[model samples]
Target: MWNHTEVTKKLSIKFPIIQAGMAGGITTPELVAAVSNAGGLGMLGAGYMTPEQLESDIQKIIKLTSKPFGVNLFVPENPVVIQEEIERANQLLEPIRQRLGIKKKSHLPQINTSVFDEQIQIVLKYEVPVCSFTFGIPPRETIHQLKKNGIVTIGTATTVKEAIMNEEAGMDMVVVQGSEAGGHRGSFAEPFDDSMIGTMALIPQVADHVSIPIIAAGGIMDGRGVFAALILGAEAVQMGTAFVTCVESGANELHKKAILNGTEEQTVITSAFSGKPARGLKNEFIVKMKEHEDSLPAYPIQNMLTQDIRSEAAKQKKSEWMSLWCGQNPRLSKHLHAAELIEMITNQIEEIINKFHLIKETERLI
Candidate 1:
């Protein structure tokens, strides 16, 4: 019989282990399929792809696994979308442009949730079971539409206040993203900074306040992290850095090798790559970003300026300039199949449960 937590029973997932959505190159169809088929929930990262590309990937994932999976989208915060950052970032990159062998962006760039309504519409049309949003919450209507189709909604938050807002916006669940998380910081207000709360502090408080289900994320790696989160009231745990090392992931060889070769001390938060604070591996680009934080444009501008550089770095195996996102617990990673990885976690969680019971039994005997 399947021992399902409330989350597992609700979603029909076997375990409460959810593969965190790593946008861009990490969360591929192969990775998502392997995870969901193995009895955990998997979410497809659709942040950087075109809608058609997203459709293709979703189809591929479905073909690979009959089990239910999900998709994640990034919601840009209000005010500036993509252009302000692009134009500003291009100007900032004038000096590096000469050396990078790329001409300056000739046209004035403008970016806003491109085909935003259409993408949400597609999510409904396809009847994807679960959809997650980050950076900011989607419009009220967007949330209502997804709910109407019975899509499970999750929002990411780095702080408790943001998690409250997610609940108010009617999210089915909220991912409590700690400071130690990789890739982008999911802060929705003010700016990203180390509020300094670890996963332990962040998870429980968010759980206490929100009526919706809470999913814990950050530096969680093994059974201990899973055990801790469950005790703290998280219905499930969302993990990213650990999955990046899995054989089923789409992370480049260099990227996977970097994670395998990393340490707790190797990770640092820098705004150089995207103009938003994010945890990643230490490299030359990261160093420069820290040194020139004041010089960079805001957000997507900084993100756009470095996009091509990151692309080239991936192609050439230049780990120094790439946005090699990672978490604090990366040193403990195992290079294994996605299915086997979840199984390892299951063994650990079961051991913890059994030991607790044994201790209780001894107490009764005494």
Candidate 2:
């Protein structure tokens, strides 16, 4: 079997793997605690959450496991750079507003990035052991504070340039999220379309460029995939879609079923959910939204418009109307508790490594 090294140990995790903090409340305390209790790092997705909500979740996670779990923050990165998108979203949502039982059009909520300071304070107050960010490099002062407080920091990177920038920016590690990863694309580089590199190519390339350890995230699911990533020089592996389907996960039943039922081709990257690109199963909502691509507003605005509709759709088991995120190797998703799943994966990794050794021994005799 392949020798497991220190990833969580360096990061203070019991396992080398970390569960990606899927946003929009998909990452729950139980889900995180289960993983942490099982040895892997479980991260609370605090992207859209308010400070109070974030605190409550942190408390809940603490209740579940005293072992270290991380929290993911979405750094402010909006590409729209236009105020017209707000008006555009209202007009586009005119029909949705009518059906949502609202009589008059209401202006979109204040679009502001004022929450970062407050969010950071809460993390510091709680003294969280690990905090990771997406979108771009977090402030150097904040990075210094985290390091000073003995907190391990992680930055998500989609390209070599981003990885190098992260290393320079003083991040402790970089999550090399390939294009095939579920949910949002952590593209901090120009020309987002060109940032779609797969894990097999991106991991080694990023590892080679940066002196920091790389966490392979994207299509990794089973033990064979984990072993493959370790052999590629990845210090650890992070799996998002696979854990999203776990019994302990907070994903709605429809969303969970959608992930477990999905095939590689069933998923596609679309900005229909939010103005930003994310990978989800192609459904009626996406196909219909494609017809009005020009009218779609920028993120947060587009994200808010579909919020209620997505919620209602989930209650009705309408997976087509919701964002169903999954990775390319989603077929590896299994129906098991988070802890049991980890045990199974470890066993599989051992078996795969043993088979390789057996092959090598036979070849030597020949």
Candidate 3:
């Protein structure tokens, strides 16, 4: 069957569809368990979770389902803390903060370089079936440790060079995130702008260069996308925006409604929210900060700086100020149960296969 592939065999899942482990509460235990229970690999977006929170969620997911699931982590990046940049970024954000009634300036964030190690230990302790990383590949020793424990390791890449780097570092699979993908850009080896290859182009080129399995992401929302990814040499596809609208997703109702009502032209890639370039709905926060993006603090710093504004915006039901992350194919999004979405995808694939067979028989008769 088309669903059975190297990814399915390696991950021990029934289908090659892997739910993107979106961070910031989108991948709730209930959502993860539901997808895994339905035969797709469900993942917990544990990028921002504390070690304690990770362990608790793992326990909760275990109670919800016996099927395999995965956790996605942000491979730590320690950028130099530039005090001037923080003050400048804050100066730009002050107006929005005041509008949201956020009185206190967000404290200078303490960068914890040890969080990744602690997270690795939690995965090891629980023997989580799969562990994936974004931002960049983890240390070789970390990959070796996961493999030694019989846990599968996956990495994200935006360019073919990055994909090869993941394979060289011993990753079992690499998710080739196209520029159209939602959330953060995973380009590490070069500038993200130069690595913005679309899904159709990136998948085949990376497949030729890397021996490990490839998981195609970005702008893929249905079985048609899954079918095309397989044809392009990807063994599976990872979907994030598709799942963000699922009934069980932990995304705020406003976020979900925005995506459902959004058009393809509405999404834009901006670093205004997290200091990392991510695609999402263009809004007041993004537009107002466009001029200041070049000076913003890197990643965790800017991400920490904006925490209060985002949280307050969500609480106040202000979608314009929130980080409304979405892919390029928002028009294809549907509000369905996770299981129903999976089922619809599988059924759609089956219909396409049948139509292809019918065409072949017609050609034979002619």
Candidate 4:
């Protein structure tokens, strides 16, 4: 069975599938519990949540299922430098804000301090089984604390160098996130442009060099992807886009619909929605914001500025204004229950392995 792999045994899951911790309410307790109950490691996206909110959500997940689940946090960076360029970027957004009938406000909202410290405390207090971090690896002291408390640590990497750093930092595993991943690019050591390694290419290389297990991510939409990743030396596969359409996912209806109707060409990597480069189904906001791309503020800041518009768009069911994140082959996604999808993917991988064995046996006699 697929659970015989090192990752499955280590994570105590029946399959090597990990539901990605896609933040901004997509990775709800319902979805996480559903995936965990289905034998895959469901991850809770705890980056945007406050310490109190995270504790409440974790308690809810415990009530829902006894299975182990992971929580992902965004590693905070140095303080963002404020400049007049941010003002210029706001000037650019004026037109679209007007179109949405949003009233102009006097002062810009205060930049939020990263809640990484507070969130991690909650994880340790609650004894979360696994914890993953994006944007960058956690400090050695933090990693030590988590490991001391019996938590499995995972760090996201976009390049082989980043993976090496993770291994050096004592990460239990590394999530090798390919460029085709939706939402945010987890690259931290280098610029986003230099870290566009695809899943197939990135996995084997990271696998070749790192002693720790590699969790392959990005553009993996089906069982074939899961099988391929394993063959490339990945211990498991992490999927986000595939689960977005699942009934248990917390993605808004319009966001789900946009993904369901989208073409591969419809999605583009843009920093418009958030300051960091992220892929999403392209819309009016992306197109209009392109001219001002040079002036946009850094992440958390840019993300804050656009929050109101995105919320209003979701409320109005306007696809053009909502952020619909998905992978390169989102059209391949199916509308199914979380358990049903997990079962289907498991079957496909099993069948593929069987067919491979049959082919190898036939070839030996030739």
What would the per-residue lDDT of candidate 3 be over residues 229-264, giving only the tens digit for each residue? 999999999999999999999999999999999899
Off by over 4 Å in 2: 1-3, 78-83, 94-105, 358-366
Cand. 3 TM to true fold: 0.97
**What's the TM-score of each model vs. the native?**
0.91, 0.92, 0.97, 0.95
Candidate 3 Cα lDDT to native: 0.93
List where candidate 3 sits over 4 angstroms from the true fold.
358-366
The best candidate by lDDT is: 3
Q: How well does candidate 4 score on lDDT at residue 342?
A: 92
Better of 1 and 3 by TM-score: 3
Candidate with the larger TM-score of 2 and 3 = 3
* Model 2: lDDT to the true structure: 0.82
lDDT per prediction?
Answer: 0.81, 0.82, 0.93, 0.88
Pairs of colliding residues, candidate 4: none
- After aligning candidate 2 to the native by TM-score, how far in Å is the CA of 191 from where it should be? 1.9
For model 1, residues 1-366, the per-residue Cα lDDT tens digits are 113567787788988888987887789899999999998898898876678878888888879988888888888633444555555556656655455565654553455567566567778877888899878899888898898889988898878889999999998888888888888867876456645468888988888888888888998888888768888888888999989999989998888899898988888988888777888899977775576776667776677668877776787677877888899987789999999999998888778877776443445678
Model 4: per-residue Cα lDDT over 1-366, one tens digit each: 444678888889889999999999998899999999999999999988888889999999999899999999999865465768567777777777787887873466665555788899999999999999999988899999999999999999999999999999999999999988988979999889999998889999998899998999998988998888888999999999999999999999888888888888888998988788899989888998887776788887788778878887787777787788888888878888889999999888778878877444445678
Off by over 4 Å in 1: 1-3, 78-109, 357-366
Worst 10 residues of 2 by lDDT: 97-106
